[model samples]
Target: MQRLLDGIVKFRRDDFENHRDLFKSLKSEQKPHTLFITCSDSRVDPNLITKTLPGELFIIRNIANLVPPYRETPEYVSTTSAIEYAVLSLGVENIIVCGHSHCGGCAACLGPAERLNNMPHTKRWMELAIPVRDRILKEIAKDDIEARRWMMEQANVVEQLKHLMGYPYIYEKTISGQLMLSGWYYIIETGEVFIYDKNLGEFRLANG
Candidate 1:
């Protein structure tokens, strides 16, 4: 906590003071160009990874970075609402669903259900990745832990992109070429980013 407080003070004295004009411009309204969705992992910093400034990328962070399919339910829908606002109100042109290597949420989704039984909300939220888990289990060897984790992590990004398209407005915008959808896998240790190529049906190094 003290560390965070000290960082805030440093930010005010240094970073904020250096970018006072930029911050001042953001006071009234923001017009971000992209909606970046990713895991709520401390290691995965969306702004840092993308090298985006404040008010540049509207972001949504969640467990596993899952996107539930569009559905009308009488339930609290924070992620869905953020998606709607980013696309419709903010007019973000791109939506990037990024999943990372060695993600705890992804591991939990692929792990034994009983392990997450105590974490009911987390368990339920993980259910969103069941389809990806099932596909991986059917084809990948149970003993291949590394292969399974990597495959599931990439597959989950594609799965979330599908869910993002399930939103009516998002679908319309995408088809009309008003919005673009991208799936990215970030390798935590290597600092490498792989982008999903729809035609290749695989993630290729972003630089490639």
Candidate 2:
């Protein structure tokens, strides 16, 4: 699109010029400290939210920000393999599973199956969040649309964090204090971020 092209030109002229030294250092190799996993939603910009620079966050994004529980398969698993590379190969210190409000993927998971009849691949991918859907159904009233949506988004983040622990390497690193795990819920419209607290067992405002 023309917009993307114009943005690229402007970036090369302004942003790239300003960060020339940073880009040159990253030309050879990158040593990012965090593995940021989130949705493919255009609104959820990991770098913008975290205020991280290039080579600071290794990002892996997909629908609903779901992480498939670790399993060996001859078939290529995109999300699983990326996590492996970030953790074992790149040695990222932290992994954050972020989910945002009003996510189409999360909404689809909570909706009727026929709604996704045409999107077979996406429907299959959403199976990873079935537990999240189930929990929302059980705990929240069907008439409370806002409650259901908010719960689905936050619970999905926690669910993916659980899936991340299924990775043996990630688990070992976490146990040894080499890696940290976090679940985040971002409010797109409000610019608010909530972090899951293990002690309180609920998401709390990150700023406060």
Candidate 3:
């Protein structure tokens, strides 16, 4: 807690002072260009990775960075609502669903049932990745942990992109080229990001 407080103090004294004008300009409204959705992992810093400034990337962080198919319901819908607001209200041009290497959520999705049985809510949330788990298991050997993990992580990103298209507005915008959707697989240790290439039918290094 003290560390967090000290960081805040340092930010106010240094970073904040340096970016004072930029922060002041954003006091009223924000117009972000992209909707960046990724895992709520401590190591994955969206802004740091993308080199985006404040008010540039509207972000949504979740357990597995999952996006449930669009549905109208009275129940609380945090992720769905954020997606709607980012696209409809904020008019974000791009939507990036980023899944990383060595994701605990992805591992949990591929792990034994006992791994998540204790957390009912998380277990239920992870149900969205069940198809991913099933598909990867058939494609890779059970003993090949690394291969399975890579497939599971990248497959989950692709799955969420499908879910995003289920939203009527998102689908329309995407098809009409008004909105661009991308699925990215980030390798943590190597600092490499592979983007899904629809034409190639696989993820390729962002530059390569």
Candidate 4:
């Protein structure tokens, strides 16, 4: 906590002061270009990874970077609400669903149910990814744990992208060519990012 507090002070005295004009401009309103949705992993920093400034990317971080299928209900839907606001209200031009290597949420989905028995809410939340999990299990070999994990992580990103299309506003914008959707797989060990190619049906390095 002290470390974070000290960093805050330093940011106020240095980074904030240096970028005062930009920060001042953002004080009144913000017009971010993208809605970056990614995992809640501590190591995955959306702003740091993308090198984006404040008010540049409206971010939504959640377990496994999962996007639940769009549904209409009286229930409070945090993630769905954010998506609506970003697309309809903020007019973000793009939505990036990024999933990273070694995601605990993905692992939990792949592992035995008892592993998450203690975490009821987490277990329930992961139920959203069961379709992805089921597909991977049926198609991928279970002998290689590493291969399964990697594939599951990448597939989860694609799955979320599909779920994003379930939202009416997102679908409308995408069909009209006003909004673009991207799926990204970030390898933590290599610091490499792979973008999903819908045409190729695979993930390829961004530079490649």
Q: Judged by lDDT relative to the true structure, which candidate is superior, 3 or 4? A: 3
- Residue range 1-208, candidate 3, lDDT tens digits: 9999999999999999999999999999999999999999999999999998899999999998999988999999999999999999999999999999999999998999888988999999999899989999999999999999989999999999999999999999999999999999999999999999989889999884
TM-score of each: 0.98, 0.98, 0.97, 0.98
What is the C-alpha lDDT profile of model 4 across 78-172, one tens digit per residue? Answer: 89899999999999999999999999999999999999999999999999999989998988888988888999999999999999998988999
- Candidate 1 lDDT, 70-181, residue by residue in tens: 9988988999999989998999999999999999998988889999989999998999999999999998999999999999999999999989889999999999999999
- TM-score of model 4 relative to the true fold? 0.98
TM-score of 3: 0.97
- 1-208: candidate 2 lDDT, tens digit per residue: 9999999999999999999999999999999999999999999999999898999999999999999999999998999999999999999999999999999998998999889999899989999888889989999999998899999999889888888888999999999999999999999999999999989889999975
The 10 consecutive residues of candidate 2 with the worst lDDT sum are 155-164
lDDT of 4: 0.94
Instruction: Report the number of backbone clashes for model 1.
Output: 0
What RMSD does each model have against the real structure?
0.8, 0.9, 1.0, 0.9
Clashing pairs in 2: none
Q: Give the candidate order by descending lDDT.
A: 3, 1, 4, 2
* Candidate 1: regions farther than 4 A off: none
lDDT of 1 at 32: 99
Model 2: residue 199 alpha-carbon error in angstroms: 1.1
